[model samples]
Target: MDKKEDKHKVAEEPMEHTLDCMSRLETMSDEEWNEFFSDKNSMSDCSFLLGYKEAKLRKEAIKPNAEKAWQHFHTSYIVPETTRRHMGIWIYPLATIAAILAIVFILKFVHLNSSDIDVSRPFMAFTADHAPQLITITEDGSRPNIIEGRQQRDGILINDKEADFTHASFAKKMIRSIATPRGKSYKIILNDGTMVLLNAESKLIFPTSFVGKQRNVRLIGEAYFKVKHDTAHPFIVQTEKVNTRVLGTEFNLRAYPTSDTHVTLISGSVIVCNRSNNKAIKLCPGQDATLLGNKDFDITTVDTDYYVQWKDGYFYFDDLPLVEVMKELGRWYNVDIEICDNSLLSYRLHFIAERQASIDQVVENLNGFSYLSATRQGQKIIISKKMHLKSD
Candidate 1:
């Protein structure tokens, strides 16, 4: 034979030996196996076997049909003598790895095929004319299936079979938004067990699953959060003007685009800061922080219950201004408010009214206590100072 042919023949010998050794693993005596592993020349071959075992264990842990898939692979692919002889024993482990990967792909394919559609896509889409009361938006901006969540005592009940947000594949960095339109509210339990009460005319943008160093969510309008504490990963709430950082705490944040952003600490501690100015204020229980514009933050001691009372089915106002009260009412009742008399804006009111009450009922209740009357014009409500009749 030529020199090149001899070189090729020599290279094939070690691969043949390795494959021969691997195929005999089941039948080999313990002493023979030990001797094979102990041999310095067989170190590379033994390493391949150990790596394959590790991969097999991992597949078994995550995939229920891993063993069955392996058996099928062995029968169809590994038992073929032509493939083994041509590819050689050194390639045997690689072939097995490929087979395992194929099993994973098949399993994923089956899972996707079994479902009606991909629920991992975004929630329902909203337009200027049409807005869903409550919807979730996916990462890619696609609206997926609209799940009608049922309200529970502690949280909302979403169909668990629709999507598993906590799965590792879904936990990767992906943006999602859950929103509530006017006259509606929603409660949700996140993958990390954090409970959030979303108020009307509010939207929260978060990851379907939080990955990386920090768990973060962006909020518009208002929400009351019962954050899940993880010392290793800090939870962050980002608004238009401020970011609230907490390890684990109960707090309320209101950040309407047209109004000032407010943060009220209910329990534990939080660091509220503006990214624009880097001005941060640490809030203790019973303290409230308001971000005025993008430059100034006002922190003061306030009644925490008054700020978060909307989540408890009551609109509890303590000396809140009439304009502010109307704004809150309008949001819940899905009405546009126009104050006819500017003097009535200065009227301060204190009352606890059920949120479920109609706008007419609320307006009537207010007129009984204050010198103002509200008139409904279609979806708009006009409030003015009540004109008294002169003595006839």
Candidate 2:
């Protein structure tokens, strides 16, 4: 699917309304069911079809003994007396028995060992460890950790298969993470041996371990991932609106609070997916995935050094506007940024500086570069739009 198709799907109906409808229908009384069945609508067409088909089988059921008698009555009887037709006839009941027998046969003997049971079971579990988990399975065959136990129990059991992450699904594990504010950084290692360093205000969701044929994780905000390579297992990451899939590679995905999607690949191949449209595009070494809110998502080949320099101590920029540069500053320094004018938002600045120094040093570097001046007011930094021009 394309971007336009994804937008169309989102605009087709009110998501809130759909969710409310589903909630109401999840449990309905006899009166409520009758009211629903009486109404004809294209909206309810899918649900109605399911219910109607199931109800039909119920109505077709007949007694087993009656069905046997019906089969015997149909034996090759040519005598007029035996075959005589009557208004109140044995054939009617006999036919019903035969119909029921056929229906039962079809239900019991047919559709065995098929991939027909795709159902969702709605339930939850609470445990002391590994409570919040996010399990995902990739096309290339990787699994996510669900909960610790696939069942409920009073005592702890380590040897049970239910306690294993490899045997669970995302729905079962519910792996999740909490976001921290600016000036804070944390590191965690996943069950797959992959390491993730989360920047301030970033959250990630992943299985504690792999389960199925593939590995998948979800992230919110800025984080650097060093994915462990497994030729037999593929790794994937999902963000708010896109997906990044890779096999044994290192990449940094930055879906910040202020910017659109900006995925910088350091080394290794990655695939970005847009789930709404079922579309995906791959990126190579020294490439970036740029998703623009006002434009189509695109990929640009660039210097990976400038994109991932934050993982080190330095902040690097290449033809990057000042507005973007300040956004990073606010996050790294744990300060608020305020511009005097939006027109200066287009001012482009390119430089490299260590993040350890105070904000004054950063501001001084910009001030010394040109006559452009700035001042600090509380947590905000106000900058000048009007600049002195120097000419030959």
Candidate 3:
């Protein structure tokens, strides 16, 4: 977007050439090619890199000697000789070098002004030193970010070399809760080779890996975990209010900052515990544990799928209160849900959709039984109690 940056953008050229650059390079001898492309550091200087690249669309199009193709490639973009040099090479009889350069410059500039960017270029790489370039992603209506390798490098800490993290296996010991922001998730392969998916606005930080005896991962927000079976070490998920321990199993934890934590076990044995008095309750398949942030915590045996559906494409609700259902909806829909009608808060519904679904679809589906209307004013989507008529 700046003048300095604009100088580096490649000017496009017509792709109607009958001869292929790669084929021509392939026909040349390897020795000649090696001598030509030995040191190609000026790649950014010659602006035809993208144009030369498009000229060799696919690998199959290169039918000439490999060396010749490489030499042409290196020469055309890497280290091009002026037209004066071309004149000495028994070509282009009395053509002025200045005229040829001007023509090339005009053509490339005009082409670039008329076309879109060449997306084939791996924008995340630098050709000069083969460095991996930093990528910045600023999705619409979200925070702008410059992150690398999923983790944003904290500039001050990295520059000062002050940050330190101890590597420990996640087993047995007590782990505190953790959380993440929107448009973010974490992938952690446990010490026992179990995988955990920490969803957005969630956090789970325990031992560096897994150590001691049991596999433990603290949970805050929501997460879907696959525990690895080990006779010696059992896996556990700890929350601010409850603790979930298991050996080999799959389960989900929903504990947002504004709501009570819910532990739903799907396919294996688990124990949900109270942190205050160390009270423990073992759970089997089709079981659910609810821990309020206040004091009282309850457990019941219901259709576990109803609780675990959010982990999949389904958002299932079975006789759930409106406040509770609104919490779950808030997480997946990435919106702050407000309940204006206390009378309608007791209504419950069951529905399923992929995580990337529109908020309108969710509202329309859940409002099938009641009169609920929604309107978006900026980032906030307001849901109000309305009457469901014969038609939408």
Candidate 4:
């Protein structure tokens, strides 16, 4: 064989073991992963395994050129004259290491361009179906940090350790935002001991530390708030259509951009005032007040359980319209629901199911209703009216 052929050779045994080690790592716990990589004897194995994983993940996205990768490895090292004489024996491992280096460079380029937040942007917008993000906005700019898989803390703890954030300047008028993408939810405790459970597709923007008299927060989606009772400082939740002010209370506020603003009081009294007309309504326990867009509130008594079931991992629908029911299901499943027949939109549904149930199971239960027909297509659900024969 020519010298060129020997230089490009690869060791099949190491390549095969790389795949096996990655498969085992997939099922390992944090401690197991650390222990596996800490062994000095396995240092070489760990490097190759990590490089292979990164390359494999970005294979389609990067579409790296084999010629370029080989060229990179070729220029990075010089084989000594003595080593050239035994090139066939050692060239394979050297060639493999060169390829891994190329893969790492491709990943680094992608990270700098896409994942890292730009210093000029005010906030980072995350896409659907990903983990929640905790963003901090300072006078300089904004930095979006993934709540999961991050070690550094900036002065906030999510669920006592699942995620952490801490920065010395966090106390000084710093703004923090917690955003949860579709099909995901997050619970965070504020500096004032108030607990907030953010629903899917929601964003809560607040200060890292409560300053001034009132503890204020702006919500762009749904969240269940259990405010800490401090009569001196009233807790205020601002939304697009209305502002909910309470001294101390437990309530769920749903303020999705596309949906009507709803403030359902579970315990404690809250005054919800319309942003447009400044009209206000005081909500008692078990009362739901919906902003009707004309600065009017449609206040009614409701089963408080129906409003909070999402917080507790349940989908509880009590005499809710079929369209509204489908909307809730769509948010949780990250699927789009289309009513094939417009008439089915007004059909009232009384259903209760666990959020953990498979989408197929939930769809099957919906199909059990005599007047409803439901079918699931990849990432979309079609609901139509079921035809029934009249008795002769």
**TM-scores, in order shown?**
0.61, 0.54, 0.51, 0.61
Best by TM-score: 4
Q: What is the Cα-based lDDT of residue 274 in candidate 4? A: 92
lDDT tens digits, residue span 1-392, model 2: 99978864654454334334444543767566445434545244433333333444445543235434323422311111112111342222323222223333343443331112211211111001222223222222334333332443222122212122233334344454434446555565666668787775676766655678788887888888888898787887888778788888888898764457778888888888875675778888888888765235688888888867776878898877666677677776656665554334446778789878788888877777563566666555666643533110
Q: Quick one: ranking by lDDT, best first? A: 4, 1, 2, 3
lDDT of 4 by residue, 1-392 (tens): 88756533443355456546555644777666566455554557646555544555555354545455434423332112211111333322333333333334344566422222111221101112434334322222376655544444565545422223323236367777877767677776777878888887788887777889999988999999999999999999999889999988999999987677889999989999998989998999999998874468999999989889998999999987665777788777877676665334445779999998999999999989987887888767777667551110
RMSD value for candidate 4: 24.7
**Poorly placed runs, candidate 2 (over 4 Å):** 1-174, 385-392
Give the least accurate 10-residue stretch of model 1, judged by summed lDDT: 118-127
Better TM-score candidate (1, 2): 1
How high is the lDDT of residue 286 in model 1?
Answer: 95
- The digit string of per-residue lDDT tens for model 3 on 135-238 reads 22332225534434323232211111111122332334433333345534545554346767667666666554455776666677787888878868877777
Better of 3 and 4 by lDDT: 4
Looking at candidate 4, what is the lDDT of residue 158?
52
For all candidates in order, the CA lDDT equals 0.67, 0.57, 0.52, 0.68
Instruction: Score residue 11 of candidate 3 by CA lDDT.
Output: 34
| Residue 69, candidate 1: alpha-carbon lDDT | 48
